[model samples]
Target: MNQQAISDLITKMADDELVLGHRNSEWTGLGPVMEEDIAFSSMAQDQIGHALALYRIQEEHMGGPDPDAFAFLRPAAEFKCCHLVEMPIGSYDFSLMRHFLFDHAEAVRYESLLQSEFAPLQQLARKLKGELKYHTLHADAWILQLGRAGGESYERMQAALDTCFPLACGIFEPGEADQALINDNIYPGEKVLYERWLDNIYRVLVKASLNMPDPAAITPAYGGRYGQHTPHLQPLLEEMGAVLRLDPAARW
Candidate 1:
């Protein structure tokens, strides 16, 4: 197996989790209701925990930097998270739509990773699957409820879906080592994962009476995997790393 490919894959996955986890954390006390507030906070913890685990895999097995230093000290240009996660947690509708789209994508990715040739990733994928299952369930339930509510709520959800779908598609932007990972069975490659993700989300969207934007007509917001990002990312990085930057020696 090509270790570089494995490391690249893991780094991107870890970055995605860490960035989105922070985005989720932004909702800690801001959720529309008490239940949602607790739910987002809990999921934020899960995502950050998942990111820590993946970063440790890189440090322990892939000769990468320390997890804290890597996560908190890396420049924005070095991070590999997709545009979807980097976008601010917008309104509740937008955030919920993003959560529905993103968690399902994560579900498909980890499901495929269960067969990875890399033992560490395969085991981690197994552990993460159960958590992602609930994440998707929470997203699906909210999407269905608001989508069927038939008022401003329904309209807002539809608008949020339209806004989020293209951004969500960016999550599968191919990595540099994708072909190597595919050849060595470290992963199924982004194309296969993208297809599976579409299928997986389509089932739930249909049940929710939501219209998925036609992919053929949508240009996915890409470039993040290659170190290019929306202007939003750098500031997010600054805020995320501020405390650690102030005191690099501080321990959690």
Candidate 2:
């Protein structure tokens, strides 16, 4: 196995979870309802847990920094999360659509990793799939309800989907060592995952009476993998690390 390829892949995955987890956590006291507030809070914790586990693998197996320092101390440019995960949690429609699109991609990614030749990742994927199953279920149910409501609710969902589709495509942006990882059976590769994600989400969207935009009509939002981010990320990172940064020597 190419260590660098594996490490890079792990780092990117961890960063995505860390950033999106923080975004999800923002809904803790602010969800549309009590149930939703609790749900997002739960999912946010799961994402952060996933991030911690992945970072531990990197630190133990790839000689990366410990999870705390690596996650809280990295410069925005060093993060490898896709642009999709970095966008601000907008209105409920946007956040919900983002969850629907992003989690499906995540489901496919972890399903592919289940067979990874890398043992640590394979084990982690196994555990994560269980948590992600509920996430997809939640997203699917909400998307269906909103998309078929036949009024402003449906319109808002459709609009959100159109806005998010291109950004979601960025989730599958080819990583620097993606080909090598694919060749080594470390992963099935982004292109394969992207196709699977499209199929998976399409099945649900169709059932919801939603229309998918033409793939060719939308240019995939890209560049987050190469250190480019939306302006929203830095402030998020700063807020996420504020307490930790305040007293570098303080133990949590």
Candidate 3:
């Protein structure tokens, strides 16, 4: 990929990580129990830290904007995070479902990145992979714990998943130029990645005595990768961007 295209791709990915990481952090001290609270909070910290690292490279390549400003100043519509991450955290089940979905997706992403031709990106994957192992484990643990519950609890778990699965699926949406990146061998094949997602998730659900919702009945509320986001992002951006908007002319 050319400099501009590579910069744009990584910038978008970094921005997505930045926003979703912050959103997840909002759950700190609020998870169902101390273990979950700590687990999720730590994952959130890892995510935000990784985003900052990537954003620094984006800043160096793209020029002008610092990582913090780029993260905290963006308008709601400009962010590329999937709707799955921005959806409201209604209950423990909901948040856990979101975690399961994203962690699985990121597992695939980090694994693909581990094979990246770019030395910097490969090193990044190596560093982040350490934390991702726990992230995927924690998410799977909760999925098994909750998905195994009987009766009402089981249905509630399924209900939370039914709401988010479409958004989860959108995480794999391919941009038109993504193939070039794939062909260059800088990125992995989307179809193969997606198949892995399906096989892995199906195996998990079946093991947990759960069933995935029918695809024919599923439809995403928004496609944030394509710039369509939930109404929640507006208030989220306001809280995150308020100070940045005030001091756009000021240096910190």
Quote the lDDT for 132 in model 2: 96
Candidate 1 residues 1-252, lDDT tens each? 899888888888999999999999999999899999999999999999999999999999989898999998999999989999999888999989989999999999999989989999899999988899999999999998988888898889989989999999999998778899999988889999999999988888888888889999999989888899999999998998898899898776
The whole-model lDDT of each prediction reads: 0.92, 0.92, 0.76
Cα lDDT tens digits, model 2, 177-204, are 8889989999989999989999999999
How would you encode candidate 3's per-residue C-alpha lDDT over 1-252 as one tens digit per residue? 555555655765676576678778888988778887887788888888888888877766457378877788877777777777777667888888888878887788778878877656777889888788888788888788877888877898888878878988877767666777777676685566767887778788887777887766877444686677888887987887788788777886
Provide TM-scores for the models.
0.98, 0.98, 0.91
Ranking by TM-score: 2, 1, 3
Q: After superposition, how far is residue 43 of candidate 1 from its true place, in Å?
A: 0.4
How big is the RMSD of model 1? 1.0
* Clash totals for all candidate models: 0, 0, 0
Reference-based lDDT, residue 39, model 2? 97
Quote the positional error of residue 35 for candidate 3 in Å. 1.9
